[model samples]
Target: MDHTNKLFVIKLTHTLIWMFFVAVIFYVVYSGITGAINTYTWLGIVLVIGEGIVLLLFRMFCPLTVLARKYSDSQKDNFDIFLPNWLAKNNKLIFTTIFLIGLVLVIIRTLF
Candidate 1:
């Protein structure tokens, strides 16, 4: 496929994934707030805020942003870490980082 098609497909995929994520998060937050789930405290509220910020950041500066930059500048790279076909690639690392950071934040919040 041409670069335009590749970018288009990637972007469309990203948009769909992002929409699903937002919907899930909203549903969970709504459930939490409405007592559909177990009781929640201020920590739940803070987690919701964190989720929103992370989602916004992903939407605004996604892996595809690098593709746009490369396309605009006509630059070529050896390979892309976030390429579409690297299934299950680097996922553990990314998730581990997220988990660690979230765990640390929760611990600090609990302590403080």
Candidate 2:
């Protein structure tokens, strides 16, 4: 496969993975809001936090974003994931805030 094909594959894979991640994060947040705290909830929180560490370690960029840099020269935000440019640029902030809020909700639910 050539670079074009490789880039296409990478983009498709990144989109799929990102979509799945968004879905899982949404589910976790919804569960937290609905008083569904359980192993799955904590598992999702742990996974999100773990990935946040990866982003932090990589300078707030997902590992896939770092990998995508090798394939494309475009400086746009969506160069990595299928999200909008702004969202891609601020992905870390948005996701980390969401995850932290969810964690807090879970803790509150547990305490109350």
Candidate 3:
């Protein structure tokens, strides 16, 4: 396949995998907050916090997007992924807010 096609494949894989990750993260948090205190509770918190560290390390841009930029030149908000334009543009904000809320819920449930 050509370079562009290869890049598209990589980006598509990344986007699909990321969607799964988002779902699992949310599930973990929800479970943790709802009294399912188990490994998932800690795992979920650690993973989300780790994501925050990675985001900071990448200067708030997803590392995959930065990598995709090296391969493709499309500037459309969703060019690198299948997300909506607004979502692709402000994913960090949206997910970060959700993550924070989930994290709070986890903490609160763990504490009391």
lDDT by residue (tens digit), candidate 1, 1-112: 7777676666567656545544444544454444454334344445645655764778734465466555445333312223334333443344435444444554454565
- lDDT by residue for model 3 over 1-112, one digit each (tens)? 8778877887788789679768867876676567676787677668777877987999976677788887788888777787888988888777778777777777777788
- In order of listing, the candidates' clash counts read 0, 0, 0
Q: lDDT (CA) for every model shown?
A: 0.49, 0.78, 0.77
Candidate 1 off by > 4 Å: 38-60, 73-112
What residue pairs are clashing in model 1? none
Q: What pairs collide in candidate 3?
A: none
lDDT of 1 at 21: 41
- TM-score order, best first, reads 2, 3, 1
TM-score of each: 0.42, 0.87, 0.85
Where is model 3 more than 4 Å wrong at Cα?
Answer: none
Top TM-score hit:
2
| Number of residue pairs clashing in candidate 2, backbone atoms closer than 3 angstroms, sequence gap of 3 or more or interchain | 0
Q: Give the alpha carbon lDDT tens digit for every residue of 1-112 in model 2.
A: 8766777777888889777667668767787799987788878877777877887899977677777788889989898666788887887678768767777888888899
Span of 10 residues, lowest total lDDT, candidate 2:
18-27
